[model samples]
Target: MKLETEIKKPSHQSEPDYVTGKKDEIKSYGFECTDCGADINIDFQRQIKYNWTGNTDLISESERTELKKYYGIGLSEKSHDGGYPVFDKIVCKTCGEEYLTYCGVREFSNSAYSIHVQEIQKIK
Candidate 1:
């Protein structure tokens, strides 16, 4: 299937309201294996125990500093909450090849959250 980013839903309106409520736009992300072209769906809530390493070399110094500040700890320290700058390695089921997956969630002021898959690089 093609990548779908946004889904629109009808908003609730109160009684005797003449104006139409704004539709809520939900955004999501999908991932596909780079090597085998297989669709991969990640359940971030379930797969919380995956090994995450601080591969600082993959990112720039400024990014590393930002991540450290966001997580309130050094990149070398373990973080249970999967925030930005994810450095976890995931294995593709179809190709049996390991890939370094970087993903995160962004929350908007309107209470809508979006998932972002920044990079998926195959490990040699």
Candidate 2:
């Protein structure tokens, strides 16, 4: 299937905020389809694994805090190859279309970092 044209790609603000929030964050999400304007709810289970280059010591304190917030685990704890798992696909029940969103560790300037809402891709 083709991407629904109505919904625009989401920015960082749309990411799941749980690490810093007081209330327990729910992994499951509910939102309206950007393409069809239909209500959609998706239950997330860890599906992808990311491996970073260096350990947590490479980043500054502020970056570490941000990383933990987005990734459930702190940078110090991330394994060399096993970063974090995230929801890989959100299937809209109303339209039967799939959208992709995930957070993973990346190597930059010899340091591993977490990126939220990496990309949104339509799937057949």
Candidate 3:
């Protein structure tokens, strides 16, 4: 089978929902082994950096006022949730070569987000 066909779902994952706190989850996929041309399974964990876009509907009016006073913007005073993914290591089952993968998204919003595989490095 092809690399994409071998892995059906993420080996590690998270549940995402705007209402509940359990929103962040890792995305996993597969790739062809660079050395041996065999299928490889990879896993990734999402990361959110310094950006904070808030949900005003969830916060109280007082909180919103305080956030606007501090930041000069009407925000929920929260870090931007739902970021990119970074894979620690993926070992090719066929050739035993290790790799480090870095993946990211273009934007994260209340409506949707985009995901991209940024870089892949061979470690062993």
Candidate 3 local distance difference test against the native: 0.40
Clashing pairs in 3: 14-25, 52-80
Candidate 2 off by > 4 Å = 1-16, 42-87, 105-115
For residues 11-72, write the lDDT of model 1, one tens digit per residue.
22212111113254223234677667887654443122221334333445565455446545
Q: Could you tell me which residue pairs clash in candidate 1? A: none
RMSD of 2: 12.3
Residue-pair clashes per prediction, in order, are 0, 3, 2
From the highest lDDT down, the ranking of the candidates is: 2, 1, 3
Ten contiguous residues with the weakest lDDT in model 3: 1-10
- TM-score result, candidate 2: 0.39
In order of appearance, the predictions have TM-scores of 0.39, 0.39, 0.39
Residue 108 lDDT in model 1?
Answer: 31
The digit string of per-residue lDDT tens for model 2 on 4-102 reads 332334343443322222266455445677667787653332321223322122234554344345545554554223334232456677777676443
